[model samples]
Target chain A: MRRLRSAISTASAEFQRHYAHNRRLAEELRERQERARHARPQRDLDRLERQGKMLPRQRVERLLDPGTPFLEFSSLAANMAYDGESPGASCITGIGIVSGREVVIHADDSSVKGGAWYPLTIKKIVRCLDIAIENRLPVVHLCDSAGGFLQLQSEVFPDRYMGGRIFRNQCILSKLGVKQLALVFGHCTAGGAYIPGLSDYNVIVQGTGAVFLGGPPLVKAATGEEVTVEELGGAAMHTSVSGTCDYPAGSEEEAIAIGREIVAQWDRPRKWDCQREEPEEPYYDPDELYGVLPDDIKKQFEMREIIARLVDGSRFHEYQPNYGTTLVCGFANLWGWKVGILANNGVLFNDSSLKGAHFMELCNQNNTPLVFLQNITGFMVGRAYERAGITKDGAKMIMAQTCSRVPKFTVMCNGSFGAGNYGMCGRAFDGRLLFTWPNHQIGVMGGDQAANTLAEVKLKQMQRNGEAVDQAVIERLRDETRAAYLEQLSAWYSTSEIWDDGIIDPVDTRNALGMAITASLNAPLGESGYGIFRF
Target chain B: MALALLLGAEAAGIEIVRRRPHLVVRIDGREHEVVERDEADGRTRIELDGRPLALACAADGNTRFLRLGGRNLRVSLVDPRDAAAAGEGGGDEIRAPMPGSVVTLHKAEGEAVLRGETILTIESMKLQTALVSPRDGVVELLLRGEGQTFDKDEVVVRLASPSAPGPSEPAPPEPATAEASPAADAKGAA
Candidate 1:
């Protein structure tokens, strides 16, 4: 392997302009993340304080081993939903180190609506548990949510991947021999009680924690029997009498202590070996990534410049550097784990798509993980390319990528449109983890292209119907379509819909991938071999 | 295979011969006996042909720095592939690999430029690619100004011919050379 020589001139005027523009985007990202994590109404904070409870983030921090990074998923899961009522979908989910073991932490944000589960909240929790099941990571549930929000019960409860999926995933995880622990700090009414009940181990705070299929009010309404909250399902009764919960703690802090001890007792997962070396920081400064990214979404930059700032020692062993010229495929160490990277340098052509498919097969054969840095518009479209079999070539790449036995990770570095998304491991591809940058956009096509395409279709329809082909009306419709498309194409909307794990700053990509790769090693590689290639 | 190391402007090829009782090596076709020991104070003791020297060495990526007798020297490994690629001289002109219009002009004709310095940037298929100088030379011509479009394989800019009298001298008409050499056009294509 050799160091990739960066061609970027950081002192150029263009570099300065791009630097200022992207720096502002990064700053805005920081502000949004800060607001989602900590900003809450004064009343919510006061109520939690009054109840002698720790904030959700505080509990997560104390539960994790000190100084270890927590790769949070969907930090802005519902930022565009619920009229901004649910921040982080009113819960916190991330991969963190707990008692020297890698565990996924799902802590409910009690500060928001008493930690009520919104429609998107259930979606986020289900996605988190799905991640645990996929990676075979142990789970720690900080039980504090107010069950499902009844106002949106239709969306939260009825569907296949709704509230029921969370408990279903827990059962699957336990069946797979994955460990789980729940610490109850608040009332677990109705479906929420099953969270602790399904876990292998659980701890409950004596005074504030309680678990019951039906709360006191529900019990009163249904059975015509009056009962106090403690008598119904308190920590002492559940731990001593019913054996529903294993540990009883006098306070929230004590419950966390007991939870950590329980996690320490479980067997550590045997990580399947992948080629690893002593980790080293990238030779190029990651901060330069700001300038390397273009200000405009459509504008293209060298993918090698981005790769230099991401891989270990800024070194890459480029594979077939001169053959494809559009799709850059190579091997690099990300966080010391040897990974095969497929990054789009331009529109995928027949040769480039063939190269990508071949490289993916090689990675699987070598038992190396694959990382896709997607910044593609689409495959080249033309009569010449069609005759050359661009579609089948692209299908070959997608087929090889979809059936890859080694773990795959994807980072949406920029534009992902059309079938380019599929070839590059889109959300539907079962990538172990997928992250998007703040500037990323994903759609069937770009805003202008989509608008133009629809406008053309409408124009032909109007002609066929003998309607007035009014230019003014057509222009208005184009602009409206473009505006709507642009909004939904943003990274925020993608993350809000949980299309990606989360929108991350460009500089944190290495660390995010590092954590993802480490967690993925807990599970062995999938069965090898691929379906038939078009060629 | 010999490992190439660059010190200042010079390069040396070294290969190890043996490492049993004492280290034996060949440097530039000359063999030498050597021994190395690590000192307690973080310095390396080296004996070359029965002469001893002590130095503190540190490495950053491919580059190594040595502090010996209060003088600092830097040595770096020269990857053979890179050296071979650079040795195939084709830094005379910048050509358009694809049909695109210039977005920005970083350098004008008659200006001195270093190898890898951007002469202009062109946008094609929504991609902005910088066309850089192939080697250290003076710009002889800027065929495409900002916003000017050119066809594939068209010469975007030409550096002063190396055979010219001086760096400031403009390149003379050489249609034959441009037509005959395919490697010159492929330089910018990469």
Candidate 2:
């Protein structure tokens, strides 16, 4: 073996220029994350304090063990939705250790619009619960919501991944013996009451907590009984008279303490015994990644350079270095976890596609997880590539990825376009988790190429219809379509639409992948198979 | 099981032929006694041919990297059949696998080179790859020099096998290496 000699001059002008540019992008990411965390108005904070209730984040802090890592998801969800009204999707969800057990916490941010279940809020809840089931993690729900917002019920009520899915996932978790605890700190009206009722354990705060299919107003309208709020469904009645709740607490703190005790009783689930070594920092300064990373999507950068910054000790064992040059296939350690990496250096050629499929199958057979670093224009086009069976090769890669039993993680490192997205485990592929860098762009094609294609179509359509083709009209249409496509392709926009789990800082990539892989180990790897090859 | 060793850009077949107290490994048909002298804190101390080699070995997911003989190598263990299929080409002209700038010229024209000796260094994305000789040969043409750039698959150097014909190109012009400034930020490296 030989020491990998680095040829980069760190202090060169070219390196400095790229460093400055990427540093600015990293700063921008920090600012956005900070803003999202504190988006609620000051008035709301004062109101919550005056009400003698802890903030949702404070409740989480009290529930989780001190010094444990809390990997929050979608902290800025719905940032581009709800016309700037909802922030953090009006709820907070994450994986945290509570009483020594790793549990998924879905705490509603009651500070924002009474922590109502907006469409995005429902989506976030369902997504978190799905993670809970897949990873065999228990769930702790901090119930403080006004139930579903009636105005947007249509959008959230009927979808397969919306309102009903949240309860469905809860049922699945219970059937699998994954525990759940609900701390009822606020109103649990209508469909929301099922949250606490269905949980394995429920702790209700005396005066603040209430649960019922219908609130006092709806109850009064339906029946002439005129029962008081306390008698109808308060913590006292539910805990003492009815068997709806397991524990009764005087305050939020007491309720959290009770919730912690319940979680402490459940045994920690088994995790896969993956081969591991003590983690080491990558040999290169991760900050140097800014210097080597290309700002332009068209620019070529060695995928190994980025991999060097990510894997432990920057020691990578490239799998097939020469056979498929366009796609770099290799194995590296991410936080001491072995992962098979397939990164794109250029458009996917026939050989590169076959290499990807082959690597995926190997990883599956070895029972190792995969990480895909995508930066592709698409599979190669033209007659020479077509004759090489590019389509068959791409299909083989997709099939291999589809049947892979090991966990798959995707990072949209750069431009993700066309069928390359599917081949690389896009949103539609159901990878355990997918994240994007703020500078990433995704579309069926690039904005310029898409505009040109549409413009050509419009010209042909006009000529066929016998209408005189107006050059100005065609130009206007191209610009309009290009602008819209560019906006849609942006990472921020994609995250808002839930196309990815979240938009992350480029530097946080290593830790995020580590957390995802660790959580995935809770479930055993399934068997693997694939479709017949087209050839 | 066999290991597929990607030594630089070439893949070679490796298998464990014997193991008693430790292991005897065969790499490209050559056998060596390999033993783990010490293992702790993610680093492995291995002895090959009775020469003590201290290397840092980290396993993340399925990827493994080994630091050996002052070089960092990323190695993948693969099925032996795939390794057998990865035979080296017998071309005289060596080309750039990807677009990059030449960083170092390890040998000059007419220099006798052993197989696997570093021929030239190309930097792409700030990572340097050392192109090594495929067989015992004499440098026929060294077209690229330090700081000269080349595109993917472009012929950058040529080698004359022991029994091959003489060089077609005449004596090379002496170009000052390392004196050429990087063209632009985009053209500096990959």
Q: Docking category for candidate 1?
A: incorrect
- TM-score per candidate: 0.89, 0.77
What is the C-alpha lDDT profile of model 2 across A1-535, one tens digit per residue?
Answer: 1112233556667568767877787788778777777767988889888878888989999999999888888876888888867877888898888998888999988999888999989989999998898888899999999988889989879878879999999999999888899999988888899999999999999888899999888988898668877888898899989999889999999999989989989988999987677888878777787876666655555566677777788767777766677787878777888899988866677888999999999999888899999887778766666787889999999999988999899999878988988999988887888888877898888888789889999999999999999999999999999899889888877877768777887778888888888888997887768779776
Best by TM-score: 1
- Superposed by TM-score, candidate 1 places the C-alpha of residue A396 at a distance from the truth, in angstroms, of 0.8
Off by over 4 Å in 1: A457-472, B1-3, B13-32, B35-77, B88-190
Each prediction's DockQ? 0.20, 0.06
* Residue range A1-535, candidate 1, lDDT tens digits: 7888776678777788888998898888889889999999999999999999999999999999999899999999999999889988999998999999999999999999999999889888998999999899999999998889999999999999999999999999999999999999999989999999999999999999999999988888999999888888999999999999999999999999999999999999999999998888999999999988888887767788889999999989888877676788899999999999999877788888999999999999999999999998888776667898989999999999999999999999989988989999999999999999988999888898889989999999999999999998889989999999999999988998889999899999999999999999999899988899987
Clashes of each: 0, 20
What does fnat come to for each candidate? Answer: 0.13, 0.00
- Alpha-carbon lDDT, every model: 0.87, 0.79
Best by DockQ: 1
